[model samples]
Target: MTEDSAEYLQRKEFYNRMLTVYGRKPVLEVLQDNSLEIHKLHLADSNKPAAILDDMVKLAKKRGIEVCYHDKQALSRISKNSKQDQGVAADVIGKGFQSHQSFLSSNKKHYRILALDGVTNPQNVGMIIRSACASPINAIILPEKGCAKLDPLVIKASTGTLFRAPILRCKTLASCLKAFAESGADIIGLDANAPHTLGEEPLTGAKVFVLGNETEGLSSDVRAICNKHVSIPMLNNVESLNVAVTASLIAFQGAL
Candidate 1:
């Protein structure tokens, strides 16, 4: 391959591992963590001088991190949330973040993945990440769209476990599930009216347990992709459990 092509591939791989965190306090907290690998610190030119901003700069400089100043518009584009960005953002190298293609390339003998489909609540997403990180689950399949962005609220909810969670990102849940299904992985979905319960059948080999949206459940496209469906048996008149709680159960399904 040409040198330029090689460099482009390298850059793409590098960015696939990055998670941009915005908001002043969140950026500051990320900077404070010594274990995190920060790529760069971003600041808006219009940011009014504050003690916290000064501290952020000091911390970045102390750690020899590159700092870039951008216009408010550019910074907003970088953070993807203008109102909540607070004129600051930081690029954190997520050591555990990777593309699903990368994970498939590894050719592991057996694995279990928790796939989130249209889960928009940031807290739910965070809690799910925490459970998956703490459990025997190999990774989380998080779609870039139709899901909560990795923001400060999610980081807070995860109790800082977001940085360490094995997150496999995709553009769409349906397409990712299709890819996995084609690769000999069982695409399982959680539903309320499914014929079987969650743990009734043996979950062996490559498996993906999908948790749907909070209010709407799974999207039609994602639902169509699910080859198998199972329900979490409810007691009494209870209809269902929260998505995050369901994720915890699925994460620890093997252990129990």
Candidate 2:
């Protein structure tokens, strides 16, 4: 390949691993983290003089990181959440973040991925990431849409595990699942009504346990692609467990 083509591929790979964190506090926290690989610090040009902003700039300078200023509109485009961005954003390289295709291209013979389908609550997403990180799960399939965006609340809820968690991002859960299925993965969905329990069988090969939305379980598109359905059994006439709790169970299923 030509030098320009090689450079483009390298840049694409670098960006695939980067997660842009917005909000003043979140940007500050990321800047303060010396262990993190910060690509750049972004601030709205209209931001008023403030101690925290100054601190962030100081920290970036101390770390030899680049600082960029942009108009409010341009900054919002970078942060994607104009209302909550607080006029500050930072691009932190998530060491564990990559495209699902990258993970599939790996030589690993066996792997388990926990997929979230339309789990919109940031807290729930954070808690799920925490659980997946603590367990034997290989990676998390986080769809870019129909899921909680990675923000301060999610980072806080994960107890700061979001940065270290192996997150495989995709454009849509249904499409990603279809790709996984084509690659010989067993796509399992959690349903309270399924006859089989979560740990009833020992699944081999590539496995993906999908957790659905809080109130609506799985979306119709996601449900249509599931290879099988399993439920977590409970007594006392309990119908179901929270999606986060279910994720925890699935995450630790290998241990149990």
lDDT of each: 0.92, 0.90
Instruction: Report the C-alpha lDDT of model 1 over 88-155, residue by residue, as the tens digit.
Output: 99999988999898899898868989999999999999999999899989999999989998888899
Poorest stretch of ten by lDDT in candidate 2: 1-10
Candidate 2: count the clashes: 0
Residue ranges of candidate 2 with Cα displaced over 4 Å: 1-6
Best by lDDT: 1
lDDT of 2 at 2: 67
Q: Give the lDDT of residue 138 in candidate 1.
A: 95
lDDT, candidate 1, residue 174?
Answer: 86
Question: Could you tell me the lDDT of residue 42 within candidate 2?
Answer: 95
- What TM-score should be assigned to candidate 1? 0.95
